[model samples]
Target: MPGRNDEDNKPVAVTTSLFMHPASSPHAKTVFWGMLATRPDRRGEKIALLLGAQAIVHMWEKEGARGFMTGVRQDNASSAALCNRLGISDTDWTYSVCIDPEMLGRKNLTK
Candidate 1:
């Protein structure tokens, strides 16, 4: 969580993660920065950068994390820019397919 005032301890920006990915190599330490968000009002204020840096420091110092990875949606330009600013390269692309639960039970779900 990252914020400017104690009164707003509820975090303007937040980063959360698991210490390791299930698919990660056992011989090395890894951390997955699973989620990141900054309040709509706080966007472009570097709150996300502050929180992200704090998370990385905590992982390296407290958890001995040697590898870090995260996923950002391709359409999220701000997030992609943040990643670029942080020196993280876009190494791969991931594709996802989703279906509405209501449509799951429908017979003609060709859409």
Candidate 2:
């Protein structure tokens, strides 16, 4: 992850992680990006766009990747906006389940 620091030398924004993985298609070589996050305060500052462009360049130029893929939760309007700004195509829907560590051994869980 790369970031820009404030004048006080404290990091204000960062691209937390950019993971590259092989796509499922066997006909062509492709890459998929994983997580990308920034500090809550810096959400609207275009840091994610810059980092995403850098990641794309790295993948295409350095790693010889053919294409990119990533997913954003439907409820995350911010991420969806960013994807639109980046010209990423809206592809498919995905579902996820989260488990709480404290509820691991419990028979019944309460919200």
Candidate 3:
């Protein structure tokens, strides 16, 4: 669903992409929902809420996802609020990310 073009002739649109994937951990029943975002121009419209809920249900029913989880940055109030509205509660889970320095053209340092 492409929207109006910007001043630079680039197409701008409101897109919600569901990134639910199987958890790589030993817990096979968990699904990791990643990167749920909505443009500020379309906030307060319950778009994120609807999309997330629908995706969760589909994953649970059709994909055998027993648990759904996502991480929100501590400073992102809007995302936190949206998650709460979608009946998602905070848990004891901690989200961690690691990137290899070589991926960015740097060698790993060993002390």
Candidate 4:
């Protein structure tokens, strides 16, 4: 354990209680990459989504991620739009049911 690789020792990053796993190898691929952001309050909807996109870009750059993967609920129009704006083309028709409480709040909806 004393001579383990840093990848095995690195800690995951979390923002607003949403966690992003540590990036160990650039060649290692990760799925389900997403940013958990709450809906805009004083700020406008567009600005909030812009911030989320910025965060995604930053994470991708910092982590050396090859590509991003996330899912928008069929009912979430804004999220779908945001993903499109971020260059995430929809290629699949699968649905995911998340259990995060913060993700369930209406305030968590994107623009």
Q: lDDT per prediction?
A: 0.64, 0.61, 0.60, 0.51
TM-score of 4: 0.52
How many backbone clashes are present in model 3?
0
Worst 10 residues of 2 by lDDT: 14-23
Error of 3 at 59 (Å): 0.6
User: Compared with the true structure, what per-residue lDDT tens digits does model 2 show for residues 1-111?
Assistant: 366777888776544333333355462455555356666666667777888777777767876766566667667777777767766668663435487868776542110
The estimated TM-scores of all candidates read: 0.67, 0.62, 0.62, 0.52
Candidate with maximal TM-score:
1
Q: Per-residue lDDT of 1-111 in model 3, one digit per residue for the tens? A: 223344776543332323344357566677766355455555566666666776777777877777767777777777777778766779998868676777755632110
Query: Which of 2 and 3 is the better model by lDDT?
Result: 2
Cand. 1 Cα-lDDT: 0.64
Expressed as tens digits, the lDDT of each residue in 46-70 for candidate 4 is: 5445555655665566645566667
| Model 4 accuracy (lDDT, Cα) | 0.51
Please give the distance, in angstroms, between residue 95's alpha carbon in candidate 4 and its true position after superposition: 6.8
Which candidate gets the maximum lDDT versus the true structure? 1
